[model samples]
Target chain A: MSINKIQEITSKNNARLTWEGCSILLDINDGERMVFERLTAGATLKVGNKKCSLQPLINCPFGSLFQVENGTDGPFLSRIFSTSEGSNDLQEEKESPTVYGSKDNRELMDNNTAQSLTGEDIDELRRKGASGVEIIEALITNSATFEKKTSFSQEKYRLKKQKKYSPRVLLRRPTARSICEAYFKKRPEQIGFLRMDALALLLSMASVTSHSDVLVVDMVGGLLTGAVAERLGGNGYVCNTYRGITPYPIDIVRMFNFGTEICERIVNSSLTELCATSNVTSVSSSQLEEACGTRSQSNEEGPSSSVPSLDMGEIMISSEDGDTDISPASLAVKPCKATKVGQKAPLDAIKSWRENGFSSLIIAAPQIDAWSMVKELLPLLSFSAPFAVYHQYQQPLALCMHNLQVGKMAIGLQISEPWLREYQVLPSRTHPHMQMSTSGGYILSGTRIFGSK
Target chain B: MLSMELENKVSFKRCIREGDLVIVYERHDNMKAVKVCENGVLQNRFGVFKHSDWIGKPFGSKVFSNKGGFIYLLAPTAELWTLVLSHRTQILYVADISFVIMYLEIIPGCLVLESGTGSGSLTTSLARAVAPTGHVYTFDFHDQRASSAREDFEKTGLSSLVTVGVRDIQGEGFPDEFIGQADSVFLDLPQPWLAIPSAGKMLKEDGVLCSFSPCIEQVQRSCETLKSCFTDIRTFEILLRSYEVRGERLESWENHAGGSLGSRKRRQRSTDGSNGVEASVSATIVARPSSEGRGHTGYLTFARLRCVI
Candidate 1:
């Protein structure tokens, strides 16, 4: 009956529009800052020094844009409708490239007097009810070097001022790619430096599909678990197995707007329980209950929650003190206690896994040695099932690959490193980003073969 | 390649059955898709192998040829199918394919659109991502290529999830019936800018679109067109560098000098007994990037449809 209820909810929730309790990724000032928050009535998002309620964003669709405006009450986020003028400007610029000035910046000076507007003057303008755009215009009119700059630099100057005066927030859905990117950008260590490209490779290498049972060792928080669960879409089980009775903390799963159906499919079981001989089911069930008890106790302690060390108050305070460049921080403000995920795998599910074996396996335990762990876990997968192991360092995966080859337990073994480089594709200036991630770690992928035994 | 039905799933009891499409793997790079019939026999570099020997065996079984050479019979997965599919056009490899799927935010029950069905390499993986509940409508200009892709999807058991049409999307855009119904659209065409307007019309609010091109000029033009109705446009080039691993034993030169890392004591004993080899030899697993690999694929530019409502 609960499964049917969740199925009904899944069909209703297409995940296109934000709801009262849905999670959202807030991209502030075009990725100058990124924050994660729930869309409850009381949830507040701080843009610069102004803390505004997120109520206006509740019913809006993902990819909607909101601008921070100084309302009668205070500063608030207002929805920004798309305008055709932006595209017209771009089109005109493309058509008339020669209209850009040939002037150089040789006469430009680095002196602070380029802008006559002071902090107090800007505050005074704000008090006078001058909009952000009006203040920008006033500043430009008063600037001594406004006419001396090249057209390109003028556009750059305007963009810089826009970011500081009128901040914009773009609502983004927290999919696996966006979630991995957020963590990878802000806190790489939390997710074991698993870049989005590397994460995608893991999913593909393991062949995660609907209706396929997936076994995972998600030590890099809950990123791998949530990703597999998203691909499964509530059809099959994503069983997270651990070395001991305690399972890894998968708080990242909460960031996804997975309905009750998808959440129910994400379960956990210890390695011993999954590999326990058939006769030992009764003893393992008792152990499973014991593990469940400890898990709930840990959850109460709150150590197994969202990304550790995300201090929302500190980021807001730092930005409010006129620190323009604020390092992005993941803020989990009262994550609505939605349906529970990562529950202990039921006895039936465990028994079924033991009999049928998992369709595929993905291991992202950066702390564990790949060879030792894979040696213990590979047999739980059905013959011909693919597996991918993630590690920040290549030596571990290399040794794992060597051992697998020597033992003849797997075939098609290869260790791969993902190279991801972003480009700035502009009209006349298209090049790779000035800085890029040197490495996205390594993965050892192979397919399990039936041992002669 | 996918288990659509529970009974068809790979399990301890699920054996190689008739009419099964299996990937015959000789090496990591050497693989072929084979349709198993009762009287089917396969001839390869190793030797002649009879299909009857593999009928009752489970997938991943190592079946020996008549001349004693052996190879593996693996249950087909989308990844392996990509490697074995016929190259009707320049196909997308795993790196670009994986990145595109993730960046597009595709999941189950999502309607996806693609163009140029180039060899159906990416389409196979796309079908896997949106299987059992979703559908993929892919169009190509070449009728022969479209038909071949359809047959390939049929062989891989993905026909129910994908529909291949013979239409030049760059010239005629997508079918009008899919207006505002697609969760994501992917364009891998020479002139993707020609299809940008239709793609914008077909996407639901906030739906994502990705364009793959090998040249920066195309990307430049597409971004100009996308600025009208898309937001958060970003471009990335993704590649995979494979490494070869080997267990190598290195001999220490200091062992010849009779002192290093406490090996002197062991060397003294071994020189009087054996050849003093055991003390200096150390076996360790080492890995390095393969000397040659794909240097360039295409740049993936992803953008989200701006929500106007």
Candidate 2:
């Protein structure tokens, strides 16, 4: 907004302001030290072929723009004011304005007057020490004014109008608070009161406090069962079985490959159970297979699949193996997959759960068959504590009743103590597969492997 | 409806009406007890006295609890509202607020405009920063949300610094007068690009602007609009993970072993294992009690205003 400097005001009343092809007429008393103030409003005035508006005419002892227009015979002065309004006004008046010549002088200057200067011409004058008002007068006097064109055109005016409300800053990413709030509002009852563990885990993930590495483990029911325990220990770890589907570590790597099928697969599988349930009918086996295949491919090809794997047999082996110093290479193994109904997949799922660092599990299925299957798989995995299970159907479901470390724990079945009542073996009609023992614990009726026997 | 000067005092009174759920620290018996009522006496095993005696007194003044105990009635600050507000959702924390304010380079006496007034936590901070001469106009599409935010603002006495309105910024552009009048604009809503054109219409030339998004895809969309409307667009993520500092066992736990802090420790250990060694040496086993750590939140993006032409 600061234009070029005014060299000198030779005569106050008849001073000629010149720069580039523009000039201004300052009508002031000769020999009088006059303070020319910058025009705040209505500074754009026309006197003849030449037009002028207020400019921040620097180096003139004061910051003022005296608009002057050139006529056929002489220079004509426009609206004038004394300086002293404020520095901010001098800044505001810099906005581009239209300059016109007075109507009376229009016909007389048709042959003598010069064409009015454009904004570009004024900019050049401004760069060359001519004040905005001075530049306007110079352009008018030098060029013939057959109908001087104003500095402001309809297009320029429209552009200025369009530019009024542009934001200075654009928020590039959504805040964690905003996303969490949206999620919570939509599914409050389902999520319940966010447990301190969950809040702490979220806070850690939010990275609001300090920096630390986190190892999240996924369990059976997709619940973050160990998040609280991990949070309580002041270690950063979150356990949610649901996160296993779209491995966060993998997602972090391929985040930039846009339009690729990998990205599409990630987006399609990003939702939680609600989305899963809604789209369940639409999900074909081929899609599920493809998802599983992609996970396998990533595990084989990506560097992030270094997460440890747990084996059931290694856990059930004698105490000697527990004491043995296992090498890191011996411990490494392929990631586990869910067992198909008929296929005899390795009992590695439970092993993987243990290796991943989860101490508990929650089961949502109501079938006793599933519970038996889980019981059959536990001994095959290496874990210190009895994996806790919560039955979703029961009001205030029983959790963490058995003390596996202290008692005669069953490896496979061994008709050992059953934690839940009404326990029965699946594919059986003859007798209760499980019966109550005199000590309040129930015993299994079927034969199962006993790792410790 | 009160002016900003009077709003703070009234907000304190409203906090009292709201059960003074936010605790004020007062010393009594070398311990602190909550001041429950403005008029009723605070009685404890130590002594009892009325809170009205401290009404006109300046904040941070000492008052007597009924139990003959002395308590400090520290005035409620913005931090208190952040902790005590009945959050219908996760509220923006101090960390994000600090970063957003600093990165945006918000100045005093500048007009700031924001949309999607979520919980008003950030709004309160913005209002406080640009007080006296500055103004903040916040918009939210949901009436209920706006009302809740208004209540909080009124209680906090920051309502005067801000103007709260319930309207969809995407559907209706900013008012004509406000166009090119704002010094800055912040969009915290989903699909913020929908309002970019509107933002362009309201900001002064070369003003500052910023946005908050969670996913990279969202960032990509926002960046496209930002590059078109403004210059100097940039994006980044802030990660905060805490360490466990307890007595001589000052070390981070192994649970948070995947973050930047973990890498730093690993680098240190690789250089000097003797310095890193402590109680346990098992490679995979977490040797020490892991200190709690913070992890992922979201991404942040920033941009600066430029001449459209």
Candidate 3:
């Protein structure tokens, strides 16, 4: 009970501090490895070969940086103050004009004998209580080519050595931006290769805002559901509708630091349930009853087996994402106090949706046919309500747009693929990133119209 | 233009009443905002459209002009408004605006600040993100621009969620009253570096800031200034590539090749008769990016306030 209360107090959408039992994103060594964890007394993070308890991270601000240090017990994480920020070296160098030395890399050899220090000597220094920074300094001092290298190569050498010896873990808030980027970079398949820009465009095109009734078909592992819920901010209802009896899993919504208020707003309902009151003639009553029966049976088994134990202390760091994995499942089980987010939508809410229709609709179900899904779901939106549908392939959306145009069911129809290019802005060295995602995906956006019916 | 209440939302029961703002959409690229009045009428290329004909009609209804030409009257949304708003200055489009909102992490309860509220394009979306419980404070140097933005907010029914002030944010910085209270800040000025320090002061720990510049040099200077009190500085350029779709009928090479002219004529005649003949016709849907699009908008540089106690 005490842990639950602590989580509630610190789980605000904009909370700055990391509380016990709270979810966090650990960025190790400038995104060399990213991990999501729940702060508990027994939780641990693996940096290099050593594992350290995360108890020291509780009650700290989100942007604090921690460096691994050798303590009496073993390797532990210690907070590095602002005075020793590693980025300061780069910042200071940029202040002065960078003048290339007369020396060139033509004389540099590819042989592996650049340093005189042996592995045994480094281990001896570690055993004698030398910190990671001190070890890096010692390695730099012993390198035979340290003085002969240009300033640029010298900085690169130091950066590479620092990553190996002293990796820093930056505490970051698990917002939609950071979470989407992590999933896209590490595991694009889980989220359907839905890039961050595409997700943002979908939310904007759908006009998701506070107090608006938004209908969504999120097949991309609940990333769409969670992004919509974050924008709803606990005011509007984000009703995730699906086909058949069983609802899709929304495991990613748990990554957001949403309090119970927002969690309650995220509900799910089957298409039959939503359309039952709308007098949809496609589904017969006998079939609807069978669907309901299956739903009730699944409901009985849902909480017992599907709901992972929210015990914070039992959480573990996922090692599969060796370099960048904000393991979604680990954070999904973090919010022990949250009333399950994807509960069955209440009957009264469904009744209102059938009567008034949803204010907006956003569909990201890549597995289903876009035109057929829109045909059944567009009528569920209020007249003049906007909608955005996302798909990895452009053909389905093109066909969907053409069909909608021919049917006169929507206006302002446009299929747009968002292109994002990131730039590395620096003094006299600003240019776009050499590599970027070619396609975030295509989105077909339009406003639903009032049919003659 | 927004649903301040449940009843205000577009629905079967909600219809166009007097004193409402509606977007008269003639085509995908043609739209204009008009306020509904009892005696108002709009004259355009389509024809003369009487406001009386639109009254009591549900939004998204296709209303006819006196000449039998018609146009759709849709309830205004932030995205639609961006396309139709008069450009008092170079405005932010959907691609840049959407990315900024997501990166800033704006929610319903977050307080946001912006400078040089040009045409109130992004401000409209910002107000939408921080509605029901939050607010957006926008400042511009030009008094007329600021007042025009105020009028636009009022017309859009977002006055309660936004405030437009006439202040030079670059020269004067944000007001002291907002010191350490803002959840996010945005800058779109010629010299954003001058306002970077004030944006840092106005943010809570871990709050985010964004600066939009049209040139790489400006981005270089802004990033340099941001390094003093911000972390995780990143710059991105987001553009939308719109695709046009159409169904094209192509003559199948295998069907048309090595066939006499009479056979080709016979095939054309039977194209609509059977599924096999239709398959030979190859009526396929194709999509391609539009020939011309916005090549560049600006560089968006985002940073987070350093969490130092």
- Note the residue pairs that clash in candidate 3: none
lDDT of every model, 2 decimals: 0.81, 0.37, 0.81
lDDT of 1 by residue, B36-103 (tens): 99999999888999999999999999999999999999999889988998887888999999999999
Q: Which stretches of candidate 3 lie over 4 Å from their true place?
A: A1-11, A83-103, A107-110, A279-339, B253-282
Predicted structure with the largest TM-score when compared to the true one: 1
Residue A413, candidate 3: alpha-carbon lDDT: 86
How many collisions between residues are there in candidate 1? 0
- Score chain A of model 3 by TM-score against the reference chain A: 0.85
- Every model's DockQ: 0.44, 0.02, 0.46
Q: Write the per-residue lDDT of candidate 3 for residues B170-286, one digit (tens) a residue.
A: 999999988887889999999999999999999988899999999988999998899889988889999999987765655667856685565533322211223423433355767
lDDT of model 2 at position A382: 20
> Compared with the true structure, what per-residue lDDT tens digits does model 2 show for residues A301-382?
3223333222211122222212121111111112322111111111222223323222222222323333443443333222
TM-score of chain A of each: 0.87, 0.21, 0.85
Taking all chains together, each candidate's TM-score versus the true structure is: 0.90, 0.33, 0.89
**True lDDT of residue B266, candidate 3:** 36
